[model samples]
Target: MGAQKIVRQEADTVGENPLRLEKEKAEQIVDALNTDLADAYVLYHQLHKHHWNVEGAEHLGVHEFLEEAYEDVEDAADELAERVQTLGGVPHASMTALSEAATVEPEDEDVYDVRTSFENDIEMYGSIMESYREHIELAENLGDHATGELLRQHLLELEEHVHVMDHYLEDDSLVQS
Candidate 1:
């Protein structure tokens, strides 16, 4: 067979071509996913650290809730990384990458207060929700229905988390003297 035929055979064997426009679309989705994953991971670590070290009246509630959120976000990060790898791209994990990509600001050393923590979490979750929604849109545009469906489920969960955190933060404001 000719060289072009061999290239076509290889491409067929490996499934979709990764260098095409669709792969670029996949990469675009992965870029947003990568940023969100980094942000979520950073927030997850910060929440876990705060959970261990928080010293206040709502310590247990805050710690336990934050841990739950952390677990959810960690799972999401794993799935997104796998998706990135599936698209023949690397998912970033370094702290430097997280710092640069994070839409959620770094956890303040002085932000140990329950209300502050909740506010930070609400902001982070909101950013994540937006990214997930955008990923869903991109998946739809690319005709990747399976990815779109998966992203919808993840977006729903993120929305719920954001709503719950928002409620908690609002309640915290109300409870303040």
Candidate 2:
């Protein structure tokens, strides 16, 4: 009788569903999704730029890696934009808007040396990881576990890119020596 009573109480509490968000949480989540979308779009552009311009003997290696990176970034971009729209926010569309709002800088063709590319990629990935961390935290705070998990996966992939690029950067120095 005691166990049955306890189960009834638990079922009643579960039916009450205490985790529903007030309006503020929804607004915060939508804002975060929009900001992340804009940033991801900018990063996609940078990766595509790198993919098109990387040269020398490592061109094939770098080009292939960059293409993969950009593809991932492009997916993130599309997801983010759609997510923003789903939340009723307009994603930044113009190049000027993206450039102004982006945390990462636009890529410069003149600075496309192997060493410079590696260094810039590291910097970009670091910025991206940091931003993703913030987004993950925000999503978690808003009880958006799915978004948090996605950001975690994205952060891990970016970390791997940074590690692989580190090797290339080191190798570039050895070649000069």
Candidate 3:
């Protein structure tokens, strides 16, 4: 992939209003939230890609699962971006910015077995959960309750996703020998 040029937006002229949280703390939380948002966006696209291309013994099942997963991820990404705006920081809207900020790396668009796809998804969820945990801890330490709560919800959802993926792997019936 070619290197993407990142264009930074000019600072907004709106004077700081009266949010109780310290500006520095809020900025830190915003930074973390933006990263999470970018990761979510990338993951969303990955899930969508898999949804369209997945084929195997579990074709329909994996297809449907990816549909639901990507939808949920899209919603979560929107929420993360909105949270960044609420904290008075510009959300990373450009693909370049998102790619730069994201913790999730895009996978090669190669045909893979259902098992491999599931394994890749599981790994991605693990990385996302790790980032969520770190952000949650940082938010709580900064006394940014709202951001912490938002991240906690995401963390729970990601944990459930990981569990479901693990279950898929554990169930031998889901895999064709």
Candidate 4:
């Protein structure tokens, strides 16, 4: 049987949200959350790829770190999706939808050295971080304090991982050039 839409929730319409945020503001917040959700999935997959492909003397450490980071990204993605739903918006779930909505780019399938992977990861994380900052401000200006707080927490976590990745890039670090 061919897949078909049955009970379709219109993409552009806002439903009854318990949060009671104004419709326009809720729509804006939902759009931001969906974008973050899409970016999180992209970052998660990249981290998972690096975790599987990492090699060299520092392989074990880098691999474990990537696993932990990917897990965290997954958690954040879940939160973003939940927030989107709470705001009466459909969360972007399909790969095409997510890829289209994501602002951050992922690296290609080629397996790079750990250092190269970390460099790419750092760049993606930075982009996501910047996006989150804007989202937090957007939420705050819209009087959605809950969403702003959520983004703020995710930003701090992403920043922590980026800091660790930066140290891994240092000349004296184990995963170095």
Winning candidate number (lDDT): 4
- The all-Cα superposition gives candidate 4 an RMSD in Å to the true structure of 2.1
For model 4 the local lDDT of residue 37 reads: 94
Against the true structure, candidate 4 reaches a TM-score of 0.93
User: TM-scores for all candidates?
Assistant: 0.76, 0.77, 0.88, 0.93
Candidate numbers sorted by lDDT from highest down: 4, 3, 2, 1
Model 1 poorest ten-residue lDDT run? 6-15
Model 3 lowest lDDT segment of ten? 9-18
Q: Candidate 3 — what's its lDDT?
A: 0.82
Cα lDDT of model 4 by residue, 141-167, tens digit: 999999999999999999999999999
Quick one: ranking by TM-score, best first?
4, 3, 2, 1
Best by TM-score: 4
Q: lDDT at 13 for candidate 3?
A: 17
Q: Per-residue lDDT tens digits of candidate 3, residues 130-176?
A: 99999999999999887889889878877887787788777668455
Relative to the true structure, candidate 3 reaches a TM of 0.88
Residue 140, candidate 4: Cα error in Å is 0.6
Question: Which digits, one per residue and each the tens of the lDDT, describe model 1 over residues 92-137?
Answer: 7677876787777757676567667777777777777777787788
Q: List the pairs of residues colliding in candidate 4.
A: none
How much lDDT does each candidate structure score? 0.69, 0.70, 0.82, 0.92
Q: Look at candidate 2 and give me any clashing residue pairs.
A: none
RMSD of 3: 5.5
In candidate 4, how many Å is residue 94 off?
0.7
Candidate 4 error regions (>4 Å): 1-5, 174-177
